[model samples]
Target chain A: MNKGLLIVLSGPSGVGKGTVCSVLRSKMPNLTYSVSATTRPPRQGEVDGVNYFFKTREQFQEMIARDALLEHAEYVDNYYGTPRDFVDRTLASGKDIILEIEVQGALKVKEKFPQGVFIFLMPPSLDELKQRITGRGTEEQHVIDHRMSVAAEEISLIRYYDYAVVNDEIDAACKRIESIIIAEHCRKDRFMSELADMLPASEKV
Target chain B: MNKGLLIVLSGPSGVGKGTVCSVLRSKMPNLTYSVSATTRPPRQGEVDGVNYFFKTREQFQEMIARDALLEHAEYVDNYYGTPRDFVDRTLASGKDIILEIEVQGALKVKEKFPQGVFIFLMPPSLDELKQRITGRGTEEQHVIDHRMSVAAEEISLIRYYDYAVVNDEIDAACKRIESIIIAEHCRKDRFMSELADMLPASEKV
Candidate 1:
């Protein structure tokens, strides 16, 4: 079996990353969505290992210190991290692993695993994004403005990603993500070891 | 409209490239198969510009002299080449173009158009390839052996390609090629220009 790929997807809050990922996970069978470990208390009906691997703040720090986490970030006094073991196991089992992380965490993973495919999702337009954020009717006008500002900053980092999919339409975005995954598997470097086994005896010399 | 992609595909003979290309062309409506210009005399029922852009030896040599060809090669006292104009026109019209050439010519195009996507198709195994070559029943046993020997040399150059698709199954191979085309379009460099245009006016300053 071929080894699985590690894909890191990052985008700003209102870019529709979740919608695209949800569709892609349904379409692709061998994908494993990495469940993050968090120190935040579960609100309700959240199960450990399913919703998150709930850990104490001290335990999370210990894991970080021991390098057990692939990547971790502190947000609003809560510790959230990707445990390394599950990711490694999934890859070893020939299942593609997806890490839906922020830009900072995604950059760290890119540094650690240079071969990992990094994808940044973008909204079609700033006005459209503002409309979507405001259309949610959950955030204040000022909060929406702040989100838009942060999105602008994130868009500038698009050059650092391997691919960028614009969420103009959910189906189109999902198809693009699926295509990127398929193409990455066809990469020459990924097939070299398999090809070596198929080389003719004379050519093996 | 966004400009189309120039994809250069090359592999050894009997690697099922034709089958893959045929399937991919059927699946992708915007794809244009590049017709080559050749000095070889047209066979019965062959149509100029459809089968090949039939050219005189003098005209072919003139094209080489003027650098009108993207890539060209001499074989059996006849030259085969890809004209740059038609390809450029097709791309300008926002249609993807495919060049089905040999490894030598493919690499030459790479040198000229560094941005063109290069893919190498390979057979499942050497024995499988030899079987496919012999199974055709058109070539003599000695000719089949010669072809197999040449295939070895071509396989050695597979590392130079950006992607490789194993021709174990035709449908899967076609999907892989199609995915590569879609994924290449999502590459960061391609999206950065569009992203820059979409940035908010305030941020642009």
Candidate 2:
């Protein structure tokens, strides 16, 4: 089996990326979601390796020193990062992995794993995104307005991504992501070795 | 409408490219097949621009001199080439065009239109390819042997293609090609304009 693709998916908060990923996981059983390493203590019912690899602050610092983290950031006094070893192991086993990150984190991963497929999930429109955010009924108008501005900044980074998948409908978005992964496998660079094996020894024409 | 993709599909003879394309055309009604202009007179029932754009030798040479042909070659004393204007017009109309050509011709098109998606169709195996060629009952053993050697040479050029689609099954091959085209549409370069338009104007956070 060929090595799995490292896919980095990023979008604004209200773009429905989480829902699309959940649907995609259901559709693609072989897909592995990369569990992050974090300094924060896990909540109840969260399993190690399944949810996040629980790491102490000291251990997380050591991982950074060793270049073991693909990309990491400190959020609310807690360290959160993707473990390079785990991602390499999972990909070497021929299972595709998806990393859901914010725009800055996604760009960081791009620097380390340039071959990884970077996808930007977009909402159908700004109006739709506003509605989705408003439908949550948890944030104040000021917060919603701040989010819209941040989303615009993130959308501007779409040029850095290899693909832009609009999360207009859950099923369609999942299907398109699946198709992108499948099509990526057909790339000539990935299949070169197999093609070489199929070629016969030189013979007179 | 989104701009159309220029797709160049090439494979060795007897790889069932024609059959796959026929099935693909039936499945994808929006796809346009590029008809070539040739100095050779059309056979009975062949209509201009439908079967082939029949052109006099002088007319064909004039087109070449005017740089109106995307790619051209002299074969068996007849000049055959793809018209640049036709392809540009079809793509401008937002209809994807498929150019089914030999490996050499496909590579020529690539030089002119680097943006075109190049796909190399392959058989399941060399043995299968030979079997298919012999099944036609139109060539001697020597000719079949020569064709097989040439196929090997052609397969070596797969590195130049964006994707290598194995035609083990026609339906599967068509689906894979369709997926590639769809995925190509999501490419950041193609969606940049739409994304910029989607970005909201300055608003207070």
Candidate 3:
């Protein structure tokens, strides 16, 4: 049996990664979503292990020290990370797992798991990306300008990805990502060894 | 615009490559079929350039000497080969072409166009393969055994292929091949350069 694919989806902030991920999860019920460990209080209806693996600052630091986390980062006052064990277990059981993360964290994960499929999501255009960021109106003009520059930086790192999907529409983006996962499974590298099993030893030349 | 894909489908004899390819062509109206140049005399109703580029023995030999043929081989008393110019023109015009050929010819084409998508069709099992060969009933028992051994040899070459799909059912096999093609277009190598075109110079970093 083949191990499941570890699909990591990343892009610049506000590129609709969250919306796409949610829709993908709903569509592929069999796909497992990697739960993240966070040092933040769970909001209402957010179960400790379900929404986030609630951990104290000490516990989170311990995980980082032991290298139990695949990738971790501090945002505001909280530390968030991907646990390595869950990913390993789900894949070994032949179930695919997906992680929707920011670009920096995605690169860090790639360093650890080079075999994982990396997908970089992009907005229809940078102009649209700017509008998406601006529509929120939460950030000041200078801050928005800073984000645009950072978005360009993330796009520059597109070389490291296995597929770049334009998030022109949420449903269309989800469909493309799903196709990438199915296609990755059919990749020659994955099936080369499997083919050996199909041919009996006595018949091989 | 993206260039058309060079889809080469090959497999052991009696693996139903022909049936699957015909079905695929009907479904994909835009796909172009590669026409071969042959030294054999054209039969009734066979049109020049449509059915084949029928050539005299000397003309076929000249095509081989001039390196105009992509791959050529002699069978019985006739020679057949693919034309390189037609393939280049079709791809340059942004249209996909499919070549349904034997395993040996497929390997030769792969040497010249390593980037082309190579799909190796297979039977459900060797036992099934033997049955498919035996059912032909056109050959003697000794010939059937020879073909079975040859099929085994070809199955061992799956490592060179981009995908191996079992022809358990014609429709199922076609669907898998179609999925492979769709997935291939999304490959990072193909899209990496296209993404650069999407961003204007000023937006690039």
Candidate 4:
């Protein structure tokens, strides 16, 4: 059986990356969303392994020391990371894995696994992103400003990604992301290796 | 407006490339199928521009001399070539362009236009290709053998292509090609420039 592809997605905070991932997961059943292990306490209605793999700070540091995490980050006094084992197992079982990470983590993963497909999501515009952030009404003005500043740094790194999808419209962005996945699977290297075993000796010429 | 992409398609004979192209065209309305200029006589029901841009030997040679064609070939006492003007105009107008050419011509286009997306369509397996070739019932046994040999040589060059779609099922192959085209449009370079313009200054922080 052909192994599944590893996809790494990164973007600014309010680029609708989560929505794209959710829509894609709904459309594709064989996709496995890589859950990160976090050292932070679970929020209301959150479950272990479902929402996140809640790990102690010591455990998180241990995983980092052992190089067991594909990528990890410490944000807002909480440590979070993607477990390498789960992703590897999912891919080994022919299930595509998606890692929604930040630019730093994505760059690290790219360095470790050069073959992984990296996708960067972009908001329709900075103005639109500000609107979305303000519309959410969840963050204070100062926090929104901080996010906006961070977005500029992230946008500058867009050139490093293998592909980019602009989240101007949810459905269109989701479809475009899905198409990218399909196109990557149709890559020549992947197809030739898969076709090798299917060719008959007589037909090999 | 940003321009659409130019995709160059090539495959071994009897690989169901024509059928796949036809199906893909039906599904993608914005796709412009490039018409080649040829010195060959038009068959019954063939129209100029639609079937081919039939040209006199002198005209075809003049085009070759002027470098008017993207790629050209001489076969069966006739000259055939893809006109560059129409393809360029179509892509510039934000419509995708498709060029159905042989492997040699495909490589030439790739060398000339490095940004052109190259796709190679292959049969699911050599045995399956033989079955399809025999299924056509128009070729002699010797001709089939000749095609099989050529196919082997063509398969060896698959490494050069950006993508490959196995023509196991006509609809599936077409969908895959269509998806690749759509996905290519969402490339980060194209989106970043456009998105940068739409961003508001306030949101840049």
Task: Using TM-score, give the best candidate's number.
Answer: 1
lDDT of 3: 0.88
Error of 1 at A1 (Å): 3.7
Model 3, range A1-205, lDDT digits (tens) per residue?
8899999999999999999999998998999999999999999899987899999999999999999988999999999999998899999999999999999999999999999999999887889999999999899999999999889888888888888888998888888888778767777678766667778797552
Worst 10 residues of 4 chain A by lDDT: A196-205
| Residue clash pairs of candidate 3 | none
Question: Each model's TM-score, in the order given?
Answer: 0.95, 0.91, 0.93, 0.92
Docking class of 3: medium
Candidate 1 residues A1-205, lDDT tens each? 8999999999888888788888888888678999999999997999999879999998999999999988888889999999988889999999899988888788887777888899998888889888889989999878988888898887787777899988899999888899999999999989888887877766652
* TM-scores of chain A in all candidate models: 0.93, 0.95, 0.97, 0.89
Question: How much lDDT does candidate 2 score?
Answer: 0.90
State fnat for each of the candidate structures: 0.76, 0.61, 0.52, 0.63
Tens digits of per-residue lDDT, candidate 2, A1-205, equal 6899999989988898778888888898889998999999989999998899999999999999999999999999999999999889989998899999989999999999999999999999999999999999999999999988888888888878999998888898887888888889889889877776688656211
Q: Best candidate per DockQ, number?
A: 1
**CAPRI verdict on model 1?**
medium
Model 4, stretches more than 4 Å misplaced? A43-45, A138-140, A195-205, B190-192, B195-205
**Whole-model Cα lDDT per candidate?**
0.88, 0.90, 0.88, 0.85
Model 3, stretches more than 4 Å misplaced? A202-205, B199-205
Quote the positional error of residue A59 for candidate 1 in Å.
1.6
